[model samples]
Target chain A: GDSVTQTEGLVTLTEGLPVMLNCTYQSTYSPFLFWYVQHLNEAPKLLLKSFTDNKRPEHQGFHATLHKSSSSFHLQKSSAQLSDSALYYCALSGEGSNAKLTFGKGTKLSVKS
Target chain B: NAGVIQTPRHKVTGKGQEATLWCEPISGHSAVFWYRQTIVQGLEFLTYFRNQAPIDDSGMPKERFSAQMPNQSHSTLKIQSTQPQDSAVYLCASSRGHERLFFGHGTKLSVL
Candidate 1:
């Protein structure tokens, strides 16, 4: 079985501060990790994704690196903004099954001015 | 493109009633997934389809839950004799050739 764990249930930071949301996964096959963000009333959208490339996927100033050795893909941002306030989910998909994603419980981020 | 379309954005049903949720995947995507979201459980994978065939339904409950994708364009998740515990936001997502999923706004199901 595959699973994802996000340690932070909630993270709050002031505007312009750094942001980091922890994500770790357990899988038996080569993992494809992803970061998704959901706005207040919008659907969850892909924030970034990682394959074997080790390219450090980035989108909307947020980035995440898949460390297969560590089995982690922590989401990070150099500077936070009000628009970044949302629910962030870390997911993983791989072989042996349908290749469907297994998502973490999610981390709610609140940014203040 | 309309990423993924899930209909009846909100649904309320009496206990023991039947509820059917619809999902329209992207035009050319081959994979469709169904998930349930709630306050306690953030997101739980329910089932998925690939190429109009149910490749994995291990996440789905055997008795009351069933899913079907008769064609490439649409899929449905049905719950029979729904219980109040079934209340949650049901989400449908699709992907083309990769794992980056595009999700719908989701259907909010409330069983009372």
Candidate 2:
């Protein structure tokens, strides 16, 4: 069985501060990792996805590097904005059209001005 | 293009009653997924369908939960004898093969 773990349940920071959300996964087969963001009262949207070529994926000033060796795809931002406050989820899928996703508990990020 | 569409943005059911949630996947997508979101559990995968066939439903509850995909365009999740513990947001998602999933706004099910 595959699973995803997010270490932080809540993260609070002021605007302009750097932010990081830790994500790690375990799987028997090769994994495709994803980052999703959900704003208040809105559905989750794909933020970024891992590439087999090892290129870092980034969106909206947030970036993540997939480290197969460590089974980690940590989300990072050099500076946080108030709008960045939301729930972030890390998910993993194996190889197949019917492959199901295993999602983390999610990290609630709160950015203040 | 419209992403995934889920009917009944909100549903309130009494104990012992039945509830049905509908989902319309994005046109041209062959895979559909159902997930449950709760304050305590976060997001949990319930089931999945591919090419209008049930692929995996190991996450679904054995007795009261059931899902069906009779056509490529629509799927349904039915819960019988609903209980308070079943209250949660039911999210529907669709994707082309194994690509990034597009989620619907979700049906907020409140079992009273």
Candidate 3:
């Protein structure tokens, strides 16, 4: 079975500060990792996904690198925006197509001004 | 596209009552998935359908939960004799044979 571990509980930061939400995984097969973000009262949407070619996936001022040796894909942003306040989930899936994504417990990021 | 659409943004039901949640996946999508979100468990996979057939339901409750995708457009999750512990946000997602899942706003189920 595959599982993902993310930063526990809440992560509060002042606006413009660096953001890093730790995420690690254990998978039986080759892993395909993903990040999903859910704002208050909004559905969770895909933030970024790990590339097989090792390109760091970036979106909306956020990026994550898949470190296979470390089993980590920590989400990072050089400057956190107030709009980054939301719940962030780290998910894992098998290399097979349509494999179910196993999600972490999630980290609530609250960026204040 | 409207993405995934889940009906009855919120649902209230009494204990022992039945609840059915509706989901309309994005057109041309071959996969539809159901998940339950709670503060305690975060996001838990319930079941998934691929090409209108159930692929896996390992996370669904054995007794009260059932899901069906009768057609390509819509699927339903029915909970019989709902319990208070069943209260959570039920989300529906669809994918176009790819891993990127587009989720719906979800239906908040409150069982009392």
Candidate 4:
């Protein structure tokens, strides 16, 4: 079985501050990790993804590395923005053909001015 | 390009009623995925299809839930005798490979 855990129920930060949303996963097989962001009233969109090539996936000033040794792919941003307020999800997909993702409970991020 | 499209953005049904959700994947996508999102459970995978074939349905409830993808363009998920516990937002997503998934607005189901 595969599962993702993002313990932060809600993270509140001022604009321009650094942001980090912790993500850890457990899986029976090698897992592919992903980060999806959902803004208010919008569908969840992919923000970053991990590959077996050992490359750290990054997009929109946010970056995350897949640490197979640690089972973590925590999302980080150098500077949080007011527009970053949304729900962030950590997901895990197993290897091979059966690769549907298992998502975390979700972390609500609120960036204030 | 049109992302995943889910019909009936909202649905309200009485208890013990039947509900069906529809999803239209991207034009060239070979993979389609179904997920349920709720305030309590967040996002949970329901099922998926690859190249119009069933891949894995382990996430779906056996008795009351069923899904079908008879064609590449559309898929359906039906719930029989739906209960309050079945209330949630059903999202459809598609991808070409094991890459970034494109999601739809999702069908919000409310079982009273």
Candidate 5:
């Protein structure tokens, strides 16, 4: 079985402040981690994905390093913006083409001015 | 590309009624996935099809829920005797070679 845990239900931050949303996962097989972002009234979209080569994945000024030892791939941004408000989901997929994703209960990020 | 397409952005059904949701995967994608989103359950995997074949559906309710992928382009999810508790936004996603998935707008199913 595979599972993802995002401890933060909500994260509030002011503009220009650093932000981090915690994500950890458990899996029976080698894991493929992903970050999906959903804005108000919009479908969720891929924010970033882990590379097997160990290169930290980044998108839109947000980055995450997948640490297999810790089972963590925390999302981080150096400077939060007002538009960063959204729901963030951490997902895990096992190896192989038929693998299905297991997602974490999302973290709602609210960036204020 | 148009991405994944899910028909009928919203659906309303009475309890005990049947509802069928449709999904069109992106062209050239080999995988199609279905997920349900709710306030309480968050996001849940229902089923998926790879290469136009059913791969796994362990998350689907065995009694009333069923899914099919008769072709590579389209798939369907049907719920018989829909319950109020079954209400949620049904999302469809497609991926190529198991890479990044692209999700559709989703059909919000409201079982009243």
Candidate 6:
């Protein structure tokens, strides 16, 4: 079985501060890690993903490094924006033809001015 | 692109009633995925289809949940004897080559 763990229930920060949301996973085999963000009254969209090339994935100023050693793919940003307030999810899809993703509970990020 | 389209943005039904959700995947996409989202459980995988064929549905409730993708353009998920526990937002997503998934607005199902 595959599972993801997001230790933070909610992370609050002021605008321009650094942002970090913890994400760790357990899987039977090496899996594809993903970060999805959902804003208020909107669908969840892909924020970043692990690439086979090993380059850190980044989008909208957010970046994550997939560390197979620690089984972590923590999402980080140097400066938080007001629009960064949303629900963030860490997910993974195991190997093979199965494209289904196992998701973490979710972390609510609130960046205020 | 329209991304993914899910009909009946909201649905409310009584206990034991039946609820059917419709999803239209993006054109030329080869995969369609169903997921349920709730405040308590977050996002949960329900089923998926590739090239109009069922690939995996291990997350579906055996007795009450069923899904079908008779065509590449659209898919349906039906739940019989719906209970309060079934209340959640049902999201439809489509992808190509198992890459980044594009999600729909989702159908919010409320079973009372």
lDDT accuracy of residue B62 in candidate 6:
98
Q: Write the per-residue lDDT of candidate 2 for residues A7-108, one digit (tens) a residue.
A: 999999999999999999998878889999999999999999999899998899999999988999999999999999999999998556556788999999
For each candidate, the DockQ is 0.74, 0.78, 0.74, 0.83, 0.77, 0.80
On residues B1-112, what C-alpha lDDT tens digit does candidate 1 reach at each position? 8779999999999999999999999998988999999867788999988898887888898999999998898999999999999999999999874567889999999999
Give each model's whole-structure lDDT.
0.91, 0.93, 0.93, 0.93, 0.92, 0.93
Question: Lowest summed lDDT over 10 consecutive residues: which window, candidate 2 chain A?
Answer: A93-102
Note each model's CA RMSD in angstroms.
1.2, 1.0, 0.9, 1.1, 1.1, 1.0
DockQ of 3: 0.74
lDDT of 2 by residue, B1-112 (tens): 8889999999999999999999999999988999999877889999999998999998899999999999999999999999999999999999887888899999999999
CAPRI category for model 5 = medium
Return the clash pairs for model 2, or none: none
- Candidate 2: chain B TM-score against the reference chain B: 0.98
How does candidate 5 fare on TM-score?
Answer: 0.97
Per-model TM-score on C-alpha atoms: 0.96, 0.97, 0.98, 0.96, 0.97, 0.97
For model 2, the stretches where C-alpha displacement exceeds 4 angstroms are none
Clashes in model 5: which pairs? Answer: none
Tens-digit lDDT track of model 6 for B46-84: 999999899888899999999999998999999999999
Error of 4 at B31 (Å): 1.0
For each model in turn, which proportion of the native inter-chain contacts is also found?
A: 0.82, 0.79, 0.66, 0.84, 0.79, 0.82
Please list the residue runs of candidate 4 whose C-alpha ends up more than 4 Å from where it truly belongs after superposition: none
The digit string of per-residue lDDT tens for model 6 on A1-113 reads: 88999998899999999999999999989889999999999989999999977799999999999999999999999999999999999999857877778899899999999
List clashing residue pairs in candidate 6: none
Worst 10 residues of 1 chain A by lDDT: A92-101
lDDT score, candidate 1, position A79 = 98
The per-prediction i-RMS, to one decimal, reads 1.5, 1.2, 1.2, 0.9, 1.2, 1.0
Candidate 4 docks at the CAPRI level of high
Task: Pick the winner on lDDT between candidates 1 and 2.
Answer: 2
